[model samples]
Target: MTQKDAPTGADATIPGKLPATGHQGRQEPAAMTSTPTTTRTSTRAPLAAHGTGRVPPRSGAVLAGLCAAVLALSGCGGQKGGSPAAGSVPDGWGTLATSGVSVSYPKAGSGSGGYTVQTAGERSKYNAAAAERTEHGVTVSLITIQLGFTRADTAEDAAIAAEAGIQLGSTIRSTRKVKLAGTGDARRIDFEFGSTGEDRTPPKGTRIEGVILTGLDSKDRTFAVRVDARKGTLPDADLKRIVDSIEVH
Candidate 1:
């Protein structure tokens, strides 16, 4: 009875109480000690914030500014209203004065009258004055005057000179005698041939009508005036006016 029942409650309590104290200080809850949970962060930008489906404001303004600059530069040059300057010749007519001759031409616009004066000298074979006026869509009128110092003193001589001077390279159709009021007796030579191969102004194979006037001036000079036109372009009255206006001084 001594060993089996000697103080059983005290010994059991001592062994169990030591075990409870040791475990209480060392053990912890699983949620509290899970590697101290580091918060995760993202390194990528959102698609909606960067890839919006529209042109940027800064780029749109730049394009508009470029267009405005181009339009402003285009309006800087060129004549305003498409009209000629002041003190200029009127439309539908032109005047030219040269080589002691002056004439006004019809249907000849400003700066369209062509005049050339050649003097007689050793190097130059002859002295001549030529003028041409062309109505762009209608016809061409040309006048050539040759000064005859030793030859072409008479009307017949002037006619011969004119026949020799004409180099149209086309066939002659007819010749007749005509009287010019201001000038002396004159001869009219007509041609009904196309322009020569060398001439490119008129259409090829087009039958042009030419009227030439050969007259003797008071100073014994020979003047040959040629007026060529597309058929029916120049009226007889207009031709008469142009012929009558010729004056040599």
Candidate 2:
């Protein structure tokens, strides 16, 4: 794909080192992280309150102080475990919502190949989900949609941070800010990535492409919609349609 904006990785840079990237949104690549340290120590440090310069409340703020150890795959939140995405996905076109955030896509065998799904969990900002369409052993869809929560201060940072998953050795192409339906302060990052072909899927040295769209919902928590596929899988029209279907309630 041609570079529409300009080469920049400012989007993947987390604020003072939060999570790096679930599939990178790069779990926040199912794990790839850098520079973000989330420890499960006491609340005295208040990692969340560091940037705000505001004193943490005396009580009931314990949840606010701890950093979500999402990318690391370390259970470090309110201690809640995870669950499979709720609701049986339809075989045709369908829509699924988690923690009030939603995205629409063609379900597995619905068209455009076979798609599988993952949903949100009970924990806020900890749940992550994705919709994938694959055929045989190779990825057929141009955009595999992934949705997850972030604790960033704004959508600007979160969107920039969702770079990708299993995208070995990804390089930045361009990044630009744009508006999307039902989302606030959205940003888009386009990049080129590589595949190690470890599972003999794409073969060695296969070229992979990815995009990350981070935006804000009503509660100020950030959400990520990331897509990746073999280069030139489809046009931008279908991608736009899938992205426009996203809604954070």
Leading candidate by lDDT: 2
lDDT tens readout by residue for model 1, 1-249 = 001111111110100110000000011112221112121121111010001111111244544552232110011101222222211233454443334223334543333343222122210122133334344432233333334322444444444333332322333443444444344345555543343212223444544455555555555555554554544555565555454444433
lDDT of each: 0.32, 0.39
Model 2: lDDT equals 0.39
The C-alpha stretches of model 1 lying farther than 4 A from their native spots are 1-104, 107-141, 197-200
* TM-score of candidate 1 relative to the true fold: 0.45
lDDT of 1 at 7: 15
Global CA lDDT computed for model 1: 0.32
Score every model by TM-score.
0.45, 0.54
Could you list the CA RMSD of all candidates, in the order they appear? Answer: 54.4, 14.6
